[model samples]
Target: MLDANLSTQLKGYLEKLTQPIELAASLDDGAKSAELESLLQEIASLSGKIAYVRKDDDARKPSFAINRVGSDIGVRFAGIPMGHEFTSLVLALLQVGGHPSKASQDVIEQVRTLRGTGSDGVLRFETYFSLSCQNCPDVVQALNLMSVLNPSIQHVAIDGGLFQQEVEARQVMAVPTVFLNGELFESGRMSLEQIVAKLDTGAADREADKIRHKDSFDVLVVGGGPAGAAAAVYAARKGIRTGVAAERFGGQVLDTMSIENFISVPHTEGPKMAAALEQHVREYDVDIMNLQRAQKLIPAREPGGLIEVQLANGASLKSRTVVVSTGARWRQMNVPGEEQYRNKGVAYCPHCDGPLFKGKRVAVIGGGNSGVEAAIDLAGIVNHVTLIEFDSQLRADDVLQRKLRSLDNVTVITSGQTTEVLGDGHKVNGLVYRDRLGGDSHRIELEGVFVQIGLLPNTEWLKGTLALSPRGEIEIDAYGRTSLPGVFAAGDATTVPYKQIVIAMGEGSKAALSAFDHLIRTSAPVEAAVAA
Candidate 1:
């Protein structure tokens, strides 16, 4: 029978294995080597105990009625178990038993060789991932195979959804993420070749620089919207290292149309504004990445204390400070084909892909101001534009509704809800609908469908990473700073009530300025020290 104390002892051993190592360069080589040897010995002792438990279980479960393989190292997972990581549990149990065959032994040795020879001992790597990720299964399988090849490699898989609280505490933005020696490694799926490359460094090179800092900057903006855009243009023209990653790069201007509100610009569309903004930012060589959701902000541990911004993409960027022009998706259509065909044929904004369907029939599926506006725009480019509505009257302002009605090619279909999208392999071809009043069914033939029903902040992905408003927007102060000190947000995703282009643009500028201020106060000392 398996002893009760075995599981407890194993747990204690694993706790030691995963504890983070604090390094001081000034420490003598004897102390450093001693520390490394201690870590390796702890791992070896744990491995031996786990083997004993596995053999004991095999002898006890003779009937095979309840052949349960147990591990002493246990952590609650957050998510579902259906992903590429499903087999990881079984493999981990197998390794703990110590009955691995000769081939398995060879494989394990090879994996060790690949990791490198070191007196400092084994590094424990545990990864957490979700089944929803299509690419996660491949990653899990590769990791499993690697573990079988080398018993020195300790592997643990955690279901992301199951460990919700733990994930939030760690500020995990995406999966699959590997935590090595208690520090976050890479996120997202990586191939076996990539994994090998990551671990193939020499012992001396394995210790990565834990911090980087910078000092002083010319222009620091707080947002990435119109005002932020204008600020970035000015800053880049002055020529210093400037970079911007917003919740979105385009800001609210990308969601607008007929921008007669802007001075001297006459009538302009959201895409046109976004394009101009993109051109302006790029012309001055400002680094920009859209869809880069910022997570936490912390001062660099190094001298000079530059701020470090972590991203959902598992990337860390250091800047003097930042701009906060991250924007939001308009409320979603919440309809069936909306998610599946997003950026395929069903789009939220017309300006981004409208010209691609020039002269083709399309449907604008909403009655809101944005919906009516999209219908008018599509009518100008396509052979026909069908505006479908579930409500009796259009919700757009009188002026906007009248303009939509006046458009020659636009037809408003009322009291109708989109039932299903009709498509083949490539793109959306048509949609089936039902009339709410009379139970009548109809179908429209179109090449594209634009959903303008409403907007939802893309903040859902920021769960646990940032404090969000009850309505799902990123909550920010008047200065555009979020609850997090070094991070800021702007545009429609913020609690900014007006979903207008002009407002978002101004908010972006505000965010950029806040970020700049934060960096200036934090970065200079660190950069100077690094240079010294």
Candidate 2:
């Protein structure tokens, strides 16, 4: 079922296999099993170094194992690898076939050390994931790479849809839910260091006390997304004490897909861009506090006073200035069934989840740039796409509208108000909407729904502390200065008109410069001289 172009690409990637690899599959005689077997055979046929075999394993009827010939590295998939996870399967094969992991040497050594340390038993990592989760691939790949690095550490990615019973039993409410040795480890994207730390501690507290000591900095950044990373880097370049406090480094950017509007770069993905951002910030002397979320911000009492920033982990930071760039998160549709079927089929990211609905009908909510873009993109992957817009006309660009019109499989519906998401108890089946003009209700049968509404700033914690607009965005001046002295804001969290990465970076730089200027003007002659 691979397309010609995809088949050609797979062939090119398969040619890099340095050693022979064997794929052992145990599948019952059924249509789904037959399709999976055929796909595996096709993949094996692409290279001389790869082969497939059928086996009888009653415990895991539809499971498949990939191993280096004559080596005991056991890497297996318990379900059919399709959708976005198809890339995971490809990467696993390549990794098992002698390709080295992209993880840092430090991380690799840590994994090795973890394996060498007297283990209670085989450390099992069961990651529950959905095909549409943008963050799932990274977690799956990280665990899988660790498994390849050390055989004693086993990793299994269980598709939440296929294994609903286990998901409910474990109370997995989110995708990329990781369970270590049958206990919940983490619920979202976690760095390798964080994972290792979690394993080492094995504490029952999900939010373990991480920060122990009070920290101080000249300029403190309160986020770790593109904007905050840029702010930290810019502040550190001035040779000041810079610290960045982040719940997670990437923020909403981690949920983004292929980015074509990042200025100089012709094309890049979210994970790649996030890594570059982190690496760039690490090149400087900035102290990065990952997994530390700002719980409250207390501005300095005096002009030259130090601002105290409280963290979720009970740690506090005192800084001369604080730049708020906590960024924004995907706005959720509060309609019923939306939350119930979140990962079960109601998805926010078209790029991450579209492939899961391949050859199936799906609907795109909203008619703005994101919605139109999602519909257009999903049209190429799914059987049919319905673009729903609440407005009378589409708010997308002319070029985008023209391109969308050219797509035969896409149907655009304006003045359509989504009322409720319809779903079977286990997964999404369809949705109901009302025609604003006629006041008539209608329902469409589809397997998936992509919500591309807009973004809501992550500034709830700053409420009543910072000057925020009615919509909850931080109000800032042209110079990125907030109402509170020694406090600045930027990025989507601020009143910035555009929310693009490039724009956020520029805004972050402006905020950093503004903070530096404030410091220089307010300091004593000796301190000012030193800063200058």
Candidate 3:
């Protein structure tokens, strides 16, 4: 049904796509020089053609009302679309090109209009990073994907050690600070969701209220979780103008459906813990926005000054210091039923809600350290525990896996794929699966499912605003100062090795102390000004 020439061209494109591009040992490598050059040119041409096809498809795509746009996307673009946030740009361009994606055409068109033509000028982006940071990989990958998506955008990633001079000159405070056209756009862990939201919405204008935008604060906390809550309460009780915001509050603690690890309380739910934290923060007239994500941060112009916190809502808050207590979240499955049962019994933290299913049979779907850990924890209370794994062998740390295997109550289902989650009501009850090697179909009855897959740092909102680790967590000094001054962060957002509520809380307290110290060293004289 296709034209012979077009069909042949399509086949060639497919072949090229299937072939992996040979990367350089160094960017200046010359081993396969000639072949690589030709391949690059061919890739460029193919990309252009693909873009053309996408544009053509966009002409026929369905349109939707504008309000469906997410706030995260709008904030990301206005502040800085760097790091993981850059992935939003790549996806945005793909949407404009009519590539198959979940984003609506209208959103794509808006991005296209904003990006305009980078062809006329060179867009230089430099990110400061290091191998020691676990959160840095996602940032580099996202930015590299953006370059592939848009040829006009030139990107350069520099190791932090190699750029010591430049870092010092720029007050290099972070691992993944991004500069756009030589201007600081963002400098920390920003997510793709926030990036798209920011870009989709036009750049925000500065506020008219000088006090709200420039006045010093009694306490400025960076993160929004348990530790942040504790710090905010302490600071506000001492009569401080307290304000807290993160890409999302409750932190990684929210991903935990239940929490049995915290001392004193035998059990607690994440949402409940978060609600209590929110209530505690609110009790002292503290300014708090749960879903309102931060975009950019800047030190006040006045000496001994305030720090400015910018929000996705286009508003700015002035505080004397900050406390970064944002936490982490569960890693995604990237398989079926993951998104379908997000809040429907498919959970991550057993400490938060393990008691709900006192005798209910459930599946602990993973084989990693977290998986085995969750199985061990759940086996003591749950009716039955099925540890489902897709790998040929379990990869959990030896000791944890040994403990898990020793438990007679835990059953390991290996080399299996959960094709779907079988459920008729609001909650999950069972799963349909396939055995990879045997090529067999099977079903397992379950009352609940806990996915202890992994975790994602909640630093996507800070892309181009601070330094981030390969794991996407914020990079902080021993005292928790981020790449940017007057902007300290802590908890899971930082490059901490282990992610625990107690650790996050401790880091939050440290960040608060540091923020306070910075404030004391820099606070300016207060004037009797009108409340703006």
Candidates' lDDT values, in order?
0.57, 0.83, 0.58
What order do you get sorting by lDDT, best first?
A: 2, 3, 1
For each of the candidates, the C-alpha root-mean-square deviation to the true structure, in angstroms, is 21.2, 5.6, 20.8
Q: What is candidate 1's lDDT per residue for 48-87, written digit by digit as tens? A: 3321111222111110010113422222122223323333
Using lDDT, give the best candidate's number. Answer: 2
Best by TM-score: 2
lDDT, candidate 2, residue 174? 62
- Candidate 2 whole-model C-alpha lDDT, 0 to 1: 0.83
Ordering by TM-score: 2, 1, 3
- What TM-scores do the predictions have? 0.47, 0.78, 0.47
- For candidate 1, report its TM-score: 0.47
Report the C-alpha displacement of residue 437, candidate 2, in angstroms: 2.6
Which stretches of candidate 1 lie above 4 Å from their native place? 1-224, 230-242, 246-258, 267-307, 319-322, 330-334, 339-361, 380-384, 406-410, 425-429, 434-447, 512-532
Cα shift from native, residue 336, model 3 (Å): 4.2
Lowest lDDT 10-mer window, candidate 1? 59-68
lDDT of 3 at 309: 74
Better of 1 and 3 by lDDT: 3
